[model samples]
Target: MDVHGTVAPGFEAVRDVFAGIVAHARGGAAFSVVRRGETVVELWGGLADPDAGTPWERNTLCVLFSGTKGVVAAVVAALDVLDPEAPVRAYWPEFTAEATVGQVLSHTAGLPFVDAEHDLLDTAVCAAMLARQSPLWTPGSRVAYHPLTYGYLVAELLRRTTGRGAGALVREVLARPHDLDLHLGTPPELDARVARLVRAPDYRISTFLDDPERRRIVERMYAGLLDSDELVNSARYRRAELAAASATGTALSMATLYDLLAAGHVAQQAALARASRTWSEGVDALNDRPLRFGLGFELADPIGTYGPAEVAFGHSGAGGGRHGAWPQAQLGFSFVTNELRAEDTDTRAATLLATLYDAL
Candidate 1:
C-alpha cells in the first residue's frame, strides 16, 4: 500500500506496521506520533471513500467516535472553572442527580442511558432526559460507562459554566492556537476534507442480549446511529456537537492536541495531574472489560492500549481509533480510521502502537 506521509528516521518501523494494516484495510486511516513537541511520524493510507476512490490525504478528517471524549475532556481540564467535587446541580439547577462533576467525567455517575426515546442529535431533549432520569446507582458508587450520556451531561455543565458550547471551547482553547484541524461540531465548508466512514467486512455489533441490563444499555446507546454508515456519514452527524462521539479530524491533528496537552501548553500541570489521577476502576459492562478512567480519559490498562505506558492517558473510539499521550515517554500520538470494526478482533491501532513504543 502507498502511504501518504513521512516519518522521522527511527520511526520507519511504525510506518511499516501502518502500511501492513492499510494493505489489508478496505477503508482509510491515519497514524501520527509526536515525541517531545516534535512530530516523529505522520502516515495515512487507503481509501477515504472506497467507492469514489478518494485517497486519504494528509488532512483527511475521520470521525474519532468516543475519542471525542478525550478531546472534550482536555478542553474541560483547561477551563478549570467548576470544582470537580461540587455537585452538578450547583451549575445546572435542574440537574436532579447528586452526582458531582468529577463523578460524571469519571463515568462513575450512574446516569448511563436515558429511559425515554429521543433524538440524540437534539441536545436539549437529551439533556432534559438526562436531568429527569434518576441515577441507576448512587452517584460515585459504581463504575459504569455512560457511552453517550457522558457527553450530553458534560456539554450541559460546560454550557452552564462557560456560557458557550464544548465545541466553542475546543476551537478557542485548543484548535485555533495550536492550529489543529479537529472539531466537535465540524462546519460545512470543511466537509470535503472529512473522510467517509464505512463498516469493515467483518463488522458485527456485540449486543449483550444475554444480560438484560447490558442489552438495554447497548441498544439505547448504539442500536441505530452508531451502526448506520448512512447516518454517521451524513452532514447532520458531522455538524452535530456530539462531543462523546462525533469529533472529526485527521490523526495528526488529534496527535497535536495530545502533544500540546502533554507539554502543558493548554492546561496547568496541577490540573493535568488531577485529571490523570485514577478516578474510577471496575469492569466496564459497555465494553465487557476491566477498565480504568481518569476524568474523561481512559487510563492505561493491562492490555497495553497505549503501548505499555502504565501512566498513559487517552480515549479509544468504537472501531480502532486510539489517541492519547504517554507522559512517561514524553509522547503523544493518534491512530484514527473510518472503518468500523469489532474491537475484540481489531489490531490496527495496537500493532502501530507497539511498533511505535519499540522504535522509541
Candidate 2:
C-alpha cells in the first residue's frame, strides 16, 4: 500500500483522511500528487482483483466515467493550440449551432443528450445517430451536463474536423506528449487487464426513475436514456470513447495529465484556452446540482457544489473512481480504485474529496 513515499507541505489530517479511505475500500487503489509539475506523492494500496487475489500493481487501470471526458476534451485543447478560429461546425457542420465552438467545449451546447432515447452504448450506432440530431438548447444559452452525449459529439467533431477519432488524435497530440498510458478505447491486447465494474448492492434504476425531473435530466444526459446494470459491467463499453464519461487509465497517468495542465503547459491552442475559459463556473441550479463542470474539467468548488474550490478541478467516474484536480498547492492529485462502489458520482466521490480537503 505504501509503495510510494509520503509527500509533505500538507497537514497530518490529510494523511489520516487518505488512510481512512484506503481502509474503508476493499479493492486496490493508487493516489498521486504533483506540485508545480513535480511529483510529491505516489501511493498505492489494496488488491487489484479481490476475486483473483492479484495485488494492485502500480499499473492498474480503472474506468473513470466522466473523468475520461476530460481526456477527450484535451484533444480539443490540443487542436485549439493550433487554431482559434476553427469552428465546431468546421469540424462538425452538423453542430453549426448558434453556440460557437467555445460553447460546445464549455458544456453549454445544450445538446446534453441525443435528441431521443435509445441504447447509445453501442458506439458505432450512437455515432451515426448523433450525426443527425439538433441542439437541445441554443449553444451557450444554459448549462446542462452533456452526460453520455459528450463522447459522441466530441469524437465525431474531432473526426470530422481532423479526419481522426479523438482517441487517435489524442494519442498523437497530448497522450504521447506526456507519456500517458490512458486509452480512449481499450486496446484489445489489454482486454484481460480491464476490471469488471462492481456495482453496489442496492443500485437500482427504479430508485432514480421514480422521480420525473431526475428522469428527464438523466435521460438527456445519457443519449436520452436510462442507467442500467448492463451499462455498468460490460466489455463492449471498454473500447468506447465516451467523451464525457468512460475514459480508462491509471491514477499515475491521470495525475501526470493534471500536472501538465496545472502548470499552464496546456497545448498551444489559444482557442482551446478561450473555450475552456468560456465555460461557466459558479453555482448553476442544474449543472452543479449534480456536479459542477468547467469546459472539460470539473471545478472543485467545494464550498458551492461538491468539493473544495481552491483552484481544484477534475472529474470523477461512476462507481467510486476518480482522477485529477489542482489544489492551491498541487496540480494533479489522483484517487483511483477498482472498487466500483454503488455511489459513484455524488456520494462516495464527494466523500473521498471532502476527506482529501480536510487532510491535504
Candidate 3:
C-alpha cells in the first residue's frame, strides 16, 4: 500500500508506523500529529470508498462520532460557563434537574439517554424532553457515558447563554479563527468530501460480553437509539446538528484544533486543563471498562485509547477514530478512519498510538 503525505525531520518513524497500519488495515485511515503547534506528520492511505475506488486523500472527511464531544468540551471550557459546583438550572431556567454544568460536562449528569421520541434537530423539542425527563441516577452520583444526549445538553446551555447554537458558536469562536475544518453541523456543499463509513465485518455487542445477564443489559440499553452508523452517514443526519456525534472533518483539522488549545491562550488553556482533569473514574456501565473522564474529554486509560500518557486527554469516536493531545509532551494527535468497528478490544488505534509514543 502506498501512502501519500509528508513527515517533518526526525518524524519519519511516525510516518512509517502509520504506513504499516494502513497497508494491513481493511479500510483507509488518516493519521496526523502536531508538536509545539507545528505539523510533524500528515499521512493517509487506503480506500476512502472501497466500493467507489476512491483513495483516502488528505482532505477526506470522516465522522468523528463521540470525538465531537472533546471539541464541544473545549468550546465550553473556553467560554468558562462551567462552574463545577453551580446548578445547571442557573443557566437554563427550563432545566429542572439539579445537576451542575460541570456535572453535565463530566458525564455525571444522569440524562444520558433522552427517552422521548422527539426530533433531535428540533432543539426546543429535545431541550423540552431533556427538561421533562428524570436522570438515570442522582446527578453527579456516578459515571455512565452519555452516548448521544451530551451534545444536546451542551448545545442547550450554549444557546441559552450565548444566543447561538453550539455548532454556530463552535465555528465562530474556534474553527473560523483557527482555520480548522471541523464542523458540528456540516453543510451540503462539503458533503462530497465526507467519507462513507464501512462497518466492521464482525461487530457485535454480545461478543464482547462474557456474562449472559450483562450482555442482555447492554443490548437493551442500546436497542432504542437510532442505528448510529447509518444515521451518521445519511445526508439528513450529516446536515443536522448532532453536536455529540455528527462532527465531520479531516484528522489534520482535529489535530490542529488540539494544537490551538495546547498553545496556552489563557482562557482556552485553562479550559483545556479543566477538561483534562479526571472528573470521574470507574467502570463505565455502558462499555463495561474502567474508564476515566475529564470535563468532556476521556482521559488516558490503561486501555491506551488516548495513548500512554496518563495526562493525555481527548475523545474517541464510535469506530477506530482517536484524537487527543498530550500536554506533558506538547503533542496533539489524530487517527481517523471510515471503517466503523466495535469499540471494545479493537486495538488498531491503540497500536498506532503506542508506536507514535515510542517513536517520540
User: Per-residue lDDT tens digits of candidate 3, residues 43-149?
Assistant: 99988887788888889998897888988877877888667777888888888888998888888888876675666656567777888778878888888777767
- For each of the candidates, the C-alpha root-mean-square deviation to the true structure, in angstroms, is 1.5, 3.8, 2.2
After TM-score superposition, the amount by which residue 331's alpha carbon in candidate 3 deviates from its true location, in angstroms, is 1.2
lDDT of every model, 2 decimals: 0.86, 0.62, 0.79
lDDT of 2 by residue, 176-236 (tens): 7788878876787876666555554554332223457656666456542325546654666
lDDT of candidate 1 over 26-112, digit per residue (tens): 888999998878899999999999889999998788999899999999998998987899999999999898899999999988887
Which model, 2 or 3, shows the larger lDDT?
3
lDDT of 2 at 343: 49
Best by TM-score: 1
lDDT: which is higher, 1 or 2?
1
Candidate 1's C-alpha runs over 4 A off are: 205-213, 285-287
TM-scores for every candidate against the unseen true structure:
0.97, 0.81, 0.93
The total number of steric clashes, by the backbone 3 Å criterion, in model 3 comes to 0
Q: Model 3 off-target regions past 4 Å?
A: 120-123, 205-229
Higher-scoring candidate on lDDT, 1 or 3: 1
